[model samples]
Target chain A: MNIFNYELKINLKSSLYYLLGMIALTSLYLTFFPSFSKDTSAFINLLEGFPPEFQNAFGIDLKNILSIMGFYAFILFYILLISSIQGMNLGVSILSKEERDKTADFLMTKPVTRSKILISKLGASITIVLITNLLFYLVSYMSINLIIEDTFSFKVFTLLHLSVFLVEMIFLSIGFFIGVFLKKVKSTISISLAVVFSFFAIGAFAVNASDDKMRYLTPFKYFDTNYILKNGTYELSYLVVGIVLIILCLVGSYFIYVNKDIDSV
Target chain B: MASNIIEMKNLTKYYGKARGIIDITFNIKEGEIFGFIGPNGAGKSTTIRTLLNLIHPTSGESTIFGLDTTKYPAKIAEEVGYIPSEIFYYDNMKVKELLKYSASFYKKDSKKRMAELVDIMELDVNRKIRDLSLGNKKKVSIIQGLMHEPRLVILDEPTSGLDPLMQQRFFDLIMEENKKGTTVLFSSHILNEVQKISTRVGIVKEGKLIKLEDMNTLREKTYKRVLIESSTPIDDNYFNIKGTKDFKTVDDKLSFLYSGDINLLTNKLSTLKVHDLLIEDPDLEDIFMHYYVREE
Candidate 1:
């Protein structure tokens, strides 16, 4: 509990920066939607002018482009991108920071087991991610409500927000696995960005491929915003896969960390 | 009866193909300060780290307080305090915060003891860890390791960054802890430092513990550095005595290492026109070299 509290205190400021960045970007993007709807046809024609591959890759869905929720789905692409980076950055840095900062000897020599340390750090990171997603949901929902007089389905709106959390969880788990898997990672941000963007690039390719098998390769494809907007629910199969991956990564990390030989700095 | 506080039985560790320590075995009795002495890369840190359970052994086992170290490290750690050679803490935390966090690991309330150590070490608790110098950080390490008042204390090259005055104070602190039945396992390549505090010493070289003996016994068996200033030019063969090696002469001065009978050297010196004679105990490095050369 002391370690948990300490972790929370140490991470609080950085987590706030991520939240603020998300809020500012999401709110700024939502404000542009009111004007974007006024010129909806022009925007649609302009989107249509691009190659079909480019449109599909960028998630430019003309059918839902005019509506507020549809506009949010378009904006969800960027939101999820930023959210995943934040989650990945948090997951990668938390566990490895003790070693990278050369404080492992101090912490490891204490009476607590390595598993307890991992749990505290993981718990603190999840709490930060949870807080970020909750604030992002409120800010996005409020901004959308203020801009559009036409009512949107509250259920669909919630489903969209929930997918962001789900996607962030996947990235966070993968980031954690990477952190534990490597002997050392000098720069957590660079590693996080590279990993998150690689998966995102895979998602872009999966968009064009639209292959059922390829969707499993990328977390971005796991929560299809279009599918969520239509069915008002997450795909059960992908949700199960996401949960399984998270469990596997976390469990593997615990085993590796507990059994690891903490070499001197 | 004093029990073995620590026992390593045929313990071995290999980092892939590189050797850490091999077939190492020793025991430290309760309330004794056992010095671990070795030059750089002599596996002193490896053996200490294995005992602390920071690194697992490749084969065999080690136990502290009669409990297997690998299986019950956290349990063992409750009564053990370890200070590594290089000290590092969370840079963002103040000294007091880090000390409090360390204290939380123990079931015992260490607030009073923590305050006492802070005052003894003359540490400013309000300062951030990053703002501290190397020696100050080491002072924090010392306090944190001792604040818990653990039954077993392990220190590795603990005096490196300290000034002579602080080192003396630190030794006094350890001696105080030892008086309370704390068993200390002190490791260092600095021979004289260990000689000052240790009751017994273990010498390691090239991944093996080569010698373990009582401190007095080791001192008895080691050589003395002898320097003689003569009134006459000394003959090269004049002092060709047994157990004398590395003999050298420059003008009217002569110096050599002597390990044999003190009476025989004194008799030979009396016959010569000796102006002045000085004999001193050789440093640990010389004694260590003697052991290595003897082994080879």
Candidate 2:
């Protein structure tokens, strides 16, 4: 318990920095877009002026751009983009750093089990991502409340942030899986980026495609920002699927880490 | 009731198809300083890693404190302190921070232990690990390994970066630890250092334990160089003594590598017109080279 807390303490600073940076960037972007905080019709008009292909590529829908929920549609996709990269960097670097630095041998010689060491690292990574997402939520909420004077549903804002949090956790879990399977640090980072981007591309295509079947194929399509904007809620089935995938990925990571041949210092 | 702290029975390790170590078997008694001596790529590190349970053995078994290495690795690790040949710490961590992080694993007064080790090793804890010199970094590694005062200390090439004075100081520390009943297992290619502290020496070559014996016994059994200056050219047949392994004749001098009783060498020399004879006792280097060359 003390060791785990010690590990957490060491990582807390980096986690806070990442969180604060994300919040700062998001706030700056929101503050710059004056139309987004002012007239909803102007925001909708601005989104509609873009080419349909461009809007689809960015996972933005012009139809719901005027609604209170439409703001969430824009924010969710952007949050996923930032959070996935952050999560992947944190996960892929954790264990591989020990090997890259030639400290695995020394750490392995301690009385702790492999599982225990991994658990502590995993716990730290998760805690960091969660704290970052929480800060993002708080910052986004305050920005929306302070900047937008018009009446907007607070429930939509809550649901949007909650869905984003779930998506971030899923990416974090996938990143953990990547870390366990890859040996070299460079390869791990590269593979994690490829996997995350591929998923994002698949999700974008699924959202834009005319075929209804394509929607089920991508996790991103499940949390349709357009649907969330119109209904003020996330799709329950998609939420369940995302939760299941996260659990499976986490379990797979543990299995790989437990049996894999760990190199010494 | 043998006080064996470690025992290996025909242990072997393979990295894919390449053999890392083959059929290595040895035992180290409690409080003994056992030196694992070998040349580069001789599988010294492989055997040490296997004993520490850092890598799994391909065959046979190893037990530390009578507990199976694989089955009870955590238990064994709790009592064992390990110093790797190449010591590396996180780049951004201060020396003091790294020590504190490592010390957190053991149930001990980490701060007090850290202070004592810092004093003994004469290391600056405030400096970032990346900023330290190779010798200073190595000192930090040594301090981390010994701070917990484990029952068994496993150090691979522990004094590689230390200067002669520091090496002597390290020897003194090891001797002092041994006096307090700590079993030290150190591997090194430097034969002289191994000979200075080791009670028993295990010579590894080509992934095998070619020689394991008491340090004194190995010293006694190793081939002695006999350089003889003869009044008359001695016949090549005179060099074919029973214990001699290799014989070389140069001008008036005949040199024979004697692996047997010195008495037999003396008798052989008595038969020749030996004006002057020099018998050089084999040091660890000679013993290591003899076996390594013979194996090759």
Candidate 3:
């Protein structure tokens, strides 16, 4: 419990900063919505002038560019990219910092099992993601309602925001697993940025745009906003894939971390 | 009978293909300060890390407090305090906050003991960890290690960054804890420092335990560092005899470490026309060299 509380205390400040950054970004993007909605066709024609791949790359949906929820969905792409970075940074740093800083000997020699330490760190991460998602949901909901007058589907809006949290979970798990597997991590942000950008790029250039199987490749493509708008629910297979990926990453991390030799040399 | 507090049976570790420790076996008594002595890269840290369960042995069994270290490290750690050679803590944390976090690991209320250690170490608790010097960080490690008042304290080259005055105070503090029946495992490469504290000593070389002897017996052994200035340059092999090692000659001065019968050494020395002679007990460096030269 002490370990859990200590980890939470350390992570709390940075996570709040991430939340504030997201809120600021969402507000800034939504302010432009009132004016952007005025001339949707002109903007859509401007975007339509680009190649199909380019349009897909930027997540420009011509059909729903006028509605407030659709505009928010476009904004969610950037949020997903940013929060994934935040999640990856948190996961990588929380577990690997002790080794990076050469403090593993101090913490490992204490009267706590390795499993307990890992669990405490994992729990703190979950709590951070949970708190961030909740506050983000509340903030986005109120701000969107206040900024735009056009009626939009509440369910689709909720699902769009929910996808951000889901993607963050997968990235966090991947970061955690990488944290345990690597012997030395010189900089957490470098690893986080490198990984998140790679996935973002993979999702940007879809191998087969029509193929559902390609969605499993990158977490960024898992929840299609177009699909969410049309069906009002997530792709079940992608949700299962995300959960399974998270479990595999975390469980693999646990086993490797427990038996790992914390070599000082 | 003083039951063994730590026991190892053929403990060996290999980092991939490189050797860490090889067939090292020894026991530390319940209340004795066991000095683990060896040169750098000689597996002193490896052995200590195995005992602390920081690394698993490649093959072997070790028990601390009569509990299997691999299976019951947490239980063993409850009564053990360890100060690593390299001290590190959260960079953003204040000294007081880090110490309190460390104190929270144990079940005991260490507030009073923490206060006393802070006073004795003369540490400024308000200082951030990143702002402190190496010596100050070491003081933090010492205080945190002892705050819980654990039964067995293991120190690995703990005096490197400490000043002479602080080192003396640290030894005095360890002795005080020893008087209260806290067993200590002090590991160092320096001979005199370990000699000053350890009741028994174990010497390791090339990942192997070469010798384990009582501190008094090891001190009282026949080993002596002999230095002589001869009137004329003597033959190089003239002093070579049983249990003599590291023989070297510079101009007319001859030096060697001898652990043979004192009478034989004296009888040979009487034949030499010596201008100046000095015989002193061998320090750990010379003694370690003596063991290394003998086995090959």
- Using lDDT as the measure, the top candidate is 3
Q: Write the per-residue lDDT of candidate 2 for residues A82-144, one digit (tens) a residue.
A: 777777767776766677667777778888888888888888888777777777788778876
Chain B TM-score for the candidates in order: 0.89, 0.80, 0.86
Model 2, position A5: C-alpha lDDT score? 78
* Ordered list by TM-score, greatest first: 1, 3, 2
Q: Share of real contacts kept by model 1? A: 0.76
Residue range A90-122, candidate 3, lDDT tens digits: 888988988988878889999999999999999
Docking class of 1: medium
lDDT of each: 0.88, 0.79, 0.90
Candidate achieving the largest DockQ: 1
TM-score of chain A of each: 0.96, 0.87, 0.96
For model 1, residues A112-150, the per-residue Cα lDDT tens digits are 888899999999989888888888788778877886777
Give model 2's DockQ, 2 decimals.
Answer: 0.55
DockQ ranking of the models: 1, 3, 2
Candidate 3 regions off by >4 Å?
A: B228-246, B258-285, B291-296
Q: For every candidate, what share of the true interface contacts is present?
A: 0.76, 0.73, 0.76
Question: Which of 2 and 3 is the better model by DockQ?
Answer: 3
